[model samples]
Target: MAGTGGSNPSSAAAAPKILLAKPALVTAAKYNRGPGGGGGPDDSNRSRLPSVAFLNLLSDSWDFHTDRFLPFLTDNTDFTVVGVIGPPGVGKSTIMNEIYGFDATSSGMLPPFAIESAETKSLAKHCTVGIEPRITSERIILLDTQPVFSPSVLADMIRSDGSSTISVFGNESLPAELAHELMSIQLGVLLTSICHIVLVVSEGVHDNNMWRLMATVDLLKHNLPDPSSLSLSHPQSSDKEIKDKIQEAGEEYMASPVFVHTKLHERDSAPGYHVQVKKALNQYFSSTSFNKPSVDGGSDPTPLDLYFIPCKSNSEYQYESYYSSFWKLRDQVLSMSGPSFSRTVSERDWLKNSGKIWELVKGSSTISDYCRTLQNSGLFKR
Candidate 1:
């Protein structure tokens, strides 16, 4: 759970200047120019249109905001929840904006997720606070999370006495540093349990901290049930039966992970280098369910969903331009027929159950035990 890079180079070059749209300002402008204000017919109609802004699905305090996002979802059973996680300034929000199909060229329109501006980058700040959710016209739900292993986030949660400001571990008091580490794992477990496709992003090819973090997540994620497995009525089920059901669900379910390494240099995009990275990824996750073959009984195992996105300034790799790579990534993600729930569930129920799953993640005894081990090792100050 050690911290990785001191600064994220991906944030400096991942997003194009043209895609810089201020979501907060655009949202505020819409409310101010409502029917109450003196406006023409077109202005009123525009105000009534659905605001293309992201909602805080998970707040900074580790609380889930359910009611605010429920209005955006319908009872439609057909939908996809895609979540992204990485260190701060790794362009998590920028990639999500592209997937949301935001038209940055249009005037007065805001991107679904805001990209980190140059001013924000200069100040060494992050754009997304927690998990920001945006549902597209295609009913694709995108969740952009605050960076993991973030020094800024750690600073916010730590107190003068070294204890954590937030009670993420329930009644147990923990060092802010330890709690911050656990927070990242809990975020990964929650996304894997609730989302159909989780984007595991990294700044560059050399950094493998996120990969290690996910391996730890897979280890600690035990007896945690997915959102689809929740049920309101189980009157006849015995205690043993319930435990067995949860065990089966945990062993069978895991979100399809797509490893995205961004901000690559020209040399990193060479055909030989790309093949080596893909092979390494397959070897790293070979034992995990991420490499499981299709349920259709295909003989060959599914290859690891690995992608490399080069920096925008790299014109030498014209075949895989930054913009074109993003477009391809978006298309492949949307078209992927990922693993589905054991049973059909409505969108509202999915949101409601996801909240329950979050609680389980917070109270997980497996993760709590791991924290004790880290504390005993004296790796982080108490």
Candidate 2:
């Protein structure tokens, strides 16, 4: 017999009474959890919601994290990966947000990539720490990375003695300055290998550091295979085999780059200035694969994929308005049928292979040797 105001232990263990509230709508917010009860319409609705606005693919320590982002990617093989790299305050994330098709005017809609706010600029802080990834409803993967050659990033990685705080180059200690440079190259190489389209953004028409960095990347990114070519079983493949794989793909594989020069003053938007800038860019990348002729037999001998974005403050000028340039950029980039991987690969596999490629980038002997050379030259303190 049960005691007064108390249930029998055996009866309570056999059938416990539980109360559950009505299942809430999880699709209305990002990263919402479904009802605890399994197998219901609520679960399906929760699955259909969009992924989180952004996930850090690579952390400030240069470590990779994929678990949070892998679920968002489907087995879609037709998607394209677009990556952007540039210096701070140059609007890299802003451009990526535009490419992400984010509705800025919508109330309560957070951007896929956060733009640099006035407060952030005043504090001299960078918005993105490492590589941030986002996938759109259209299955396009966008990667917004931390600003290269950033003083704040450098400061964070520098020790009191000026050695790197992060040990990316094996056991050897690297000067913060030299390590920062290598970071830029590694980023460029990884993007070129994995992405179908890479936007090389620069702040002003006169700033050519990003151009120089890409040239360095093209020079050092030898024998680094794209994600589709990477294999799990043959992780220890010989260099010759890797070289052969790259050769089989083509003479050399590089993501088609779209050079975006932003924040141009009104005078820089003049027709003459624009033509001069285009000519200069054509001459800069003339010898690289970026200048290679299209396989489709297009007319231009050295096709230049360049876009100039004027300053928003200069919208009062008679030339192309800021919004107009952005619209044109969006249309052109969306319509472009850029280069493809050697073989078809689903988005999940791509992410996995990309992780392996990043490991290769970090352990690259070429880069390691380059760091030693820089150290020997006394260019940076050890």
Candidate 3:
């Protein structure tokens, strides 16, 4: 549901929005604040997480995550597992490996996946996953339904006597005539454990690609019920009155999603493009559900929930920046190969976009001063 706080943009005619909030939160580096990704004993990663400071911080792995809630998932929640599903070669494995540490790699170091195990089996030796039905505090399961988008994989899974449940991944990619069956089966890869949606746009967006993404969003919106009409399903829902208001305004708290033309690889104006895409989505929501103004005079619209799940090729993920950050982090931690090339993401943009942290640095006279002040001004006190 959308927020009713002034923090949210006024949107009766428009859909209120919220930030995903992960990008802003900062924490001390786990490996002695070193460039390495060592498994450290530092509490900073979890307990000392800094408050919201950046826009894309929501994409950070540990940020906004709740390990305490892990115990609540046992036989007590509607969401039991995160079913990672996506088209073949779409970096489903890569994304999951990065976020969840599944030991998936382009390197054939890990054995080819096993398809005939009746029970959950280990995809790697590091973790004994999917071996039994038993659920421990480590009960958060990451199920991998076969790639249903491909006809051959579907046939293989169906023919197998092992796991029989079929998860339709990206069934929207299927024919329009197969919508019903597809919708029922195709699983959105990030089902559980709150996987952030990283919409990797294809390398290039021709006119047709834009139409495809737009059409996909339109289809999903049409099939799902509006939050306004439904009772709050989140068991740990926040303040009671806020819950009521959110449900009341959920219908109106929408996004404006414009078909952005920029390449996902470009960094200079990505924020501008993100805002435009959001606008297009919000407008469509407004047209369908006209949420009434809050009589209580409160506002807290959050648009960050509107995920732009891109249906495109694997071009964006192959870009240098994503590869550098992910792979370099991987090498630093796992002692893998490091590529010989430039790797410099402007800390300025990320710093500036972080509202909480940026405010402190905004008045600085130089980068060194800003860095020092930022480092000293209690960036994580909140």
Report the Cα RMSD per candidate. 9.1, 12.2, 20.9
**lDDT per residue (tens digit) for residues 1-382 in model 3:** 1111122122111211111111212232310111122333344433433232321121211121222222112222211222334333334334334433434343423311222232323321111111111111222223333332443343333423332232222111222223222322222211110111122222222323423333333333221212222222332333453336444543312222212222233442244665665665445444232222344666633232122223233356423344444445333323311111011111121111222212212221232232344446544221
Worst 10 residues of 1 by lDDT: 11-20
What candidate 2 gets wrong by more than 4 Å, as runs, is 1-54, 230-233, 294-300
Error of 3 at 32 (Å): 27
Q: What is the C-alpha lDDT of each candidate?
A: 0.73, 0.74, 0.27
| TM-score pick, better of 1 and 3 | 1
For model 3, the superposed segments whose C-alpha errors exceed 4 Å read 1-80, 102-139, 145-270, 281-300, 305-320, 323-382
Q: Is candidate 1 or candidate 2 better by lDDT?
A: 2
Order of candidates by TM-score, top first?
Answer: 2, 1, 3
Q: Which ten residues in a row have the lowest lDDT in candidate 3?
A: 126-135
lDDT of 1 by residue, 207-278 (tens): 999999899888887766666674423435443554577776555568889999999988777878889988
Better structure of 1 and 2 per TM-score: 2
Cα RMSD of predicted structure 2: 12.2
Best by lDDT: 2
